[model samples]
Target: MKEYASILSKDGLKIATFSNHFRSEKGVMIITHGMGEHSMRYKEMADFYTNEGYTVISFDIRGHGLSEGKRGHTPGYEFLMDDIERVYAQVRADYPSLPIFLFGHSMGGNLVLNFLLRKPNNIRGAIVTGAYLKLGFEPPKWKIILAKLSSSIWPTLSQPTELELDALSRNKEVIRKYENDELVHDRITSAFFVNVHFAGQYAIDHANEIKSPLLVMHGMEDRLTSPTGSQDFASNSGDNVHLKMWNGLYHELHNEPEKQEIFNYEIEWMNKLLN
Candidate 1:
């Protein structure tokens, strides 16, 4: 069953969140959707966890999906962090005795990883998929320099990230749904891009600060976010981090044919952690 709720962010943005309950509950998982998508996109993934006796919770971030805010805009990185913190607090309060885990993808993964670095809380662990540590392709040097220069003057100025949708998934239905999804857009504010770019690199540099056991997964063939970044982070993130590289898989591993295998791996990982 999917239930919805709304909460006010520190900066007064009303964020939208959802909870999907399983018939039998073992624990709760909080999912974070990637850029240009909403909480609903994770229905299948959440349901998979639900069937495994886990309740799932996820939110549309301040500027995305059904959430209230300017599309693709943010006040600052600090503002975004506070919004995530508010969601974490609410979920933690609701499930006081249940173990909590986090799952974030792409841009959401970047924020979730940084959230740990900012403050390593009492959460059990995390799973990051196709995290945006470094872009598989970078924006032009001049454009990035200019965006940084003008960001303060015009915080909401839109810039296209030039993400290749074709590189997202091998499944036709998944790609089509994403392309036709009205909520999906490639334009993000100059300020948002600058903040995201800096934060992605910062998360890697401070990987050791991550206090939770982490499972980091990326596709070796991922042309969106550089897989090497994930590899490098896993290599140096001490013994607590486990890295998985899916050969020839696209950015959306959940949509791939081998998704069940990955899901089984997640089930095993989380179950062991819970035990």
Candidate 2:
């Protein structure tokens, strides 16, 4: 079922929160979305999980969606963490005893991995797709230095993400919808760039710190986030971390042609953890 709420973020921002709950829920999931996108794109995934008897909750990361903040901008990383924490707290209070899992895509995956280090011991497991632990492609070092400096002087300065939309998925219809989506935009702020860059590094440094059952999946062809990073994390991380790689898929696994196949794997992973 679709439900909505106004979440008061710790930094006093009004966040637009959305939830999809199944009648006979076996567990709950809190999803964090990628940068430059809102929470609405995950409605299909949320519905799928709900139908599978899981309640999924998510919010627009501060500046991106119906949330109250500057577009494509944030105060810092801690502020972003607080926004996710608010929804996490809400789910815990309401569900109380239900098993909870954390799910993330791209930038959201980076956030989920970071939170795992904080050791939210109550969570059952986590699922990450195309997470931004390391960029599949590298930007010029000069450009990176410029953006970092711009973040300090003009934190709200926005620039095109230059994301290759074609790399998202092979589904023509989904690509068409994404291209024409009003809420979807290419602008990303300097502050967001710096924060996520640092957050990505932090996730790698503390990969072994993740205690919860972890499943990290990435499309082998994803040009945004490196699949090798996911592989390395799973290889070096504690025994709980597992990695799944899709042969020909791109970054947006949920939007891919074989999404159901991928979903089946995710469900199986969750079920094992739930058991």
The TM-score obtained by model 1 is 0.96
Model 2 lDDT, full chain set? 0.85
Total backbone collisions for each predicted model: 0, 0
Give Cα distance to truth, residue 161, candidate 2, Å.
0.9
Which run of 10 residues does model 2 get worst, by summed lDDT?
16-25
Q: Write the per-residue lDDT of candidate 1 for residues 123-144, one digit (tens) a residue.
A: 8989999998888887789977
lDDT of 2 by residue, 1-275 (tens): 36878788877889988887454458998888997788889888888888788888888888877888878788798887777777888888888989989999999999898877763557899999999988888678998899899999999998888888888899988889888888876878999888988788788878888888998999999998899878877877898888889899999999899988988899999998878
Candidate 2's C-alpha runs over 4 A off are 21-24, 119-121
Model 1 stretches astray by more than 4 angstroms: 23-25
Question: lDDT for every model?
Answer: 0.86, 0.85
